[model samples]
Target: LEPLWLVGHTFAENTVGRLMERPPAVFATGASVGSVIEALREIVKQRMVTYVFVIEPAGRLVGVVAFRELVFADPNQTLDQIMLREPFSLRPQQPFVDAMREVVKRHYPVYPVCDDAGHLLGVVKGQTLFEQQAFEISAQAGSMVGVEKEERLATPWSRSFRFRHPWLLINLLTVFLAAAVVGFFESTINQLVVLATFLPVLAGQCGNLGAQSLAVTLRGMTLGELRGMSKLRLVGKEAWLGLLNGLVTGVVAGVGMYFASRGQTVADPVWLGAVTTAAMALCCALSGIAGATIPIVMRRMGADPATASGIFLSTITDISSMGVFLGLAALLLA
Candidate 1:
């Protein structure tokens, strides 16, 4: 082992080496096609076969021959002449992200894992590499919304309570902040009872918009697509989306509420309806920023971006939405 680094070094847990399966079919390059056929027979009898790796005397990978290629080849043909030379391989130390990129490009069913010096270690199934992480990526959606991925449908009640309650308390505190905003506009609510009617409607819109952005942001993070992307660009993109979406939805909501408020006794119904439109646009735009920014900041600080992001986003959206809605109503009507 003159170059001991390849043989002895430990890869980080998520690297291709840890997840790779034991080599299904492997033989020395010196073996004849007949001997390779016998080896395949024995190997297939013991386990499923995919590809046969051809290695050298020192166990360095030289080439590969797929099961179909070997089955169709003439038994008289030597492995040296038959095996495809210098096949694609992942080094044991390669990061999972790098391996995934390679897998995407090659679209191979199984890939060989090797050392830096090209000694074959094992092979990784494309499905095994992706399926495990697929669970992780999908589970992240629930985790963002304060649901623990590990908390199964059969999870004990006590465990469920323990998982959800802490964030629930944090959420409760945020609700009070929104409540306090309402308390600040107490006089206005008393004067114009109709403003209270659309309160839930406006809050719901902001909360939902924030959630939509949060889900998209988390998906980008999971795919490693956000790394090369500028943070400002992500923020800008969401902001513009929120603006356009908010403007259209807000106008509709405002008009709808205006009709609903016609019979209510208010000093200035028109001004109150105008406030709803303004608050909707403002809250939604701010929520989009909060949703996008929270996850990015969480990742930057080495925290799981998905951890309770929905709770935080909701809290922020609630406070801003209520504050703008109520503050505007007070200024206009009371």
Candidate 2:
């Protein structure tokens, strides 16, 4: 058995090499099972053993033998006869995230780390890999709102401020854009005061729709589910979904607008309701398209998709929803 050494490193710094430990049980392929058992007896005293690695005389991994297999094997039989040949192994230099995606379904207790030539280096426990990945997943939520992945509850106020302020500034700039859109339609809003009342309703609904799309896209990206799929297909699918969802929700909102504007004199209530329906459906569909496209574009541009994604998403939804709603009112009622 060998000692387990813990190395402190961030998730980005982790690789199979840094996480692996010396295997407690290893034997040359030609070693007899009786000799392997004898060796295991001594190895078990110092560390836990699960799978016994079998390698060539030159230290290249050739097979793996489970403890259960060894317990029932003939003492005189060589390891090659019972060991599973060409067992799965992770490369020492592979990123921990990449390795995780490969082994997620296998759920092996331990994975052997190897070099390009299949020389055994060490082994990593499944628990360690999952723990690291869990931290990364948790950090992703904060990152979406412009929080740094490295920030913690105990992070210094100054550092936290620095990490957060820039994103807020960016968010403010986007908010101003949305504001500008509303201001551009100020005359229309004044003419139809009811439109002003429903501005928040349109923005809120579209924002929620966009957020739902963003969440699904980010989850897919994190799980490597987006690999090999056409980006155009994904975006198109989201847009279609958005359109369907918008049609349903828009009908409800349009009914609400009809009642709210019944006494208004500037425009016919029925026309206002129709305008709300059209704008709601169009803006919601656009929100979905923006939600799916933003992350994909950011990733292609070498930026973290989750970094301040919410801020950007809010900006798009606000501008589009306001612009479309007010424009429709001006066109139909003014």
lDDT of 2 by residue, 50-141 (tens): 99998887788899999889988999999999999999999877887788889999999999887788888888999999887887788887
Query: Pick by TM-score: which candidate is best?
Result: 2
Instruction: Tell me how far the alpha carbon of residue 222 in candidate 2 is from the true structure, in angstroms, after superposition.
Output: 4.1
Q: Which stretches of candidate 2 lie over 4 Å from their true place?
A: 1-12, 152-159, 222-237, 262-264, 299-304
Task: Highest lDDT: give the candidate number.
Answer: 2
lDDT of 1 by residue, 144-215 (tens): 767776777899999999998887888788788888888888888898777788888888998999888888
Clashing pairs in 2: none
RMSD of 1: 4.1
Give TM-scores for every candidate, taking all chains together and pairing residue i with residue i: 0.79, 0.85
State candidate 1's TM-score: 0.79
Cα lDDT, model 2, residue 284: 89
How far does residue 100 in candidate 2 sit from its true spot (Å)?
A: 1.2
